[model samples]
Target: MFDLDLWREIFQSINKNKTRALLSGFTVAFAIMLFTILFGIANGLENTFEKFFIRTAENAITVRFGTTSKPYKGLKIGRQVRPSNKDLDYLEKEFGEDIQYMSPKISRNYQVSYKKQKGGYTVTGVAPDYQYIEKAEIKNGRFLSLKDVNNKEKICVIGRLVEEDLYLKESAVGKYIDLEGVQYKVVGVYSDGGGDSQERVIYLPYTTIQRLYLGKDDIGDISLTYNPNLTVDQALALVEEMTIKLKNRFDVAPNDQRGVRIGNQVLTAKKRLDNISSGLGALIPIIGFGTLIAGILGISNIMIFIVKERTKEIGIRKALGASPKSIVSIILLESILITTITGYLGLLIGVGILESIGSSLERYFITDPSVSSSLLFSATIVLIIAGTIAGFVPAKKASKIKPIIALRNG
Candidate 1:
């Protein structure tokens, strides 16, 4: 595989017209580099979408109570329909098998203070399943357990921003913080990757908030995830059916969408993902193929010029009993060497740039830019094919050169 003499001959040919070779190689390299970076950007865009929707499960559906806009079954219009724990119990009884995960959220705004560090923070009461819904990360201690919910523990999970505001450099876990006038022991410090705004919240057991803040039967909102295996159409159908059932239970008209606000994050995310997938599917090939064709054309043009310039040399070799096949192989080897080297360099530089940028792009919603191995492999195949064709056409033309004509022309 290591042909020293062949390489020397190729190098000699390249050095004879270094400017032209360099220019042709630059074209191929630039094309590959652009392709690599564009592909990485596409991947980054997809990652950003994944992170944007990470606050809930991909197939999660959230329901919030709203006022009845249309009167139904003798109920007056403009009546508020409030969902409570009784509704959760009813849903569990009616559709337990279909529900994957469920949680209730009740929020209150209170001034939290600890040793003169006082600020208004939104206190949220949630079930244990709420952790999954939030994708909450525990930096210290532990998240609330089901035992804490059942026992109505006065323990809370503070966010990173809360911890910073209340405790400063000290750890928040095991410390007591005053929520309004009530004292709650911090059991954990959590972060949801939602920035400072989301960090300005605390999580407590829903039952605790229900019993003390609101009535024991009160619930502000419900979050549930259905079967993940369901198709987008099926999932939306389920959401519609559940909305109707909820409206009917509260005596709101079925046609009144405002009576029950349904947040089908699954459907929303699925539709967005579908659009992204389709968009990338149509976009990447066009750009990649177009650049590749240009690169191939550049290589073909350069090879043709090289063939014309070397006509006398090719004629001399043929006059000395060299076969057309050897001339073809020589030309092909030179083309492949130029294309492969340039393309490899371009790929290396492109990937190096992406890797160096690292997670800094995440702030702009572009996280972990990367190219797939299959894409690189495909590009390599394209290079090989293009190199062969670029060489083949010129090599064929060079082989047909008559010694008498070539010598006379030279």
Candidate 2:
């Protein structure tokens, strides 16, 4: 029930010992503020790490062949193993359902030109799906399509750097650029935000490069992004199976590490993500609970002092027939009020600080340092509960005070 008289008496008690109450309130405020800041920082760090994985598919695996380390079938060691379009076809035919996106790429530096403007840039032969694998953001026009690859169309996607150098202020799309004296119509301009080096490349259909430029079916590397539903363990197992199959197909030893190397970013990304999760999970509770204990202790100690100071008053009330429940409720309500007010203020301040600086930290990849609304609500509830528990002992002692003994002590 609402009681104005009780509230007035509580305010009077606070005014009487302002410094003690202030100090107790400060403890609660500091603890909550510290917890909020730490939670923001932890989330920021996690966000920063996540950006590294965004450049490529989170569950991608790149396959590259190297020289054999072990001799097989009386063949000498150090035989170089390389993948071809036939191997790509075999894999696709065998495991079509397991693949999300797959690309067989071959890259070479060529003299690229538009009129008199000429620069040596890496031209990569890629399938339509390679655009998705690279996460290339199309600034203008469209990426390579299946029709372009199937018909071996002389179409290419130029990077932002290429567009700037060759086309200048003009649109590169629908313009023809010469790559090694062969004209390819520019279909798209793309960017990866990976800096100038990444932007100095051009992409063309793999078939066109195979038939016209390279005059071979050999691929430098094969990259594949698997189904999103597959776990890291499942992806790794698929990679192992692919490695064994490829090794057998190419006459490489089964246990030769150098023969077929599958670089699975899925495993790496998963491990890093797990580390971040474990770190934040363990750290937040320790710091938050430690601060909680400190605040509770501070409030408990001050409540004991308040009880001792009110001994004579409590004795007078008891002699006037005041109930023990009412005495306990008074102390508990005071504790809860102090904690709730201070804790809410602390949360507000902490969130404000994070929002103010969040944008500035984007260069460091720490974007949106924040806590959930549910978390804040939960903290408020915890504060009130802790306050109630802290006040209970002091309130019980005050209620037990005998009129004669309390008056004598006072």
TM-scores of the candidates are 0.85, 0.81
Please give, for residues 160-237, the per-residue lDDT of candidate 1 as tens digits.
Answer: 989998899999899999988899999999887756777788999999998888866688889888887777787888
Worst 10 residues of 1 by lDDT: 51-60
Q: What is the per-residue lDDT of model 2 for residues 214-282, given as tens digits with 9 covering 90 to 100? A: 788878889888887877778788888888888888999988888888886557667767787788879
State each candidate's clash count: 0, 0
The candidate that wins on TM-score is 1
Q: How close is candidate 2 to the true structure, as a TM-score?
A: 0.81
User: Residue 159's C-alpha lDDT in candidate 1?
Assistant: 93
User: How does each model score on lDDT?
Assistant: 0.84, 0.84
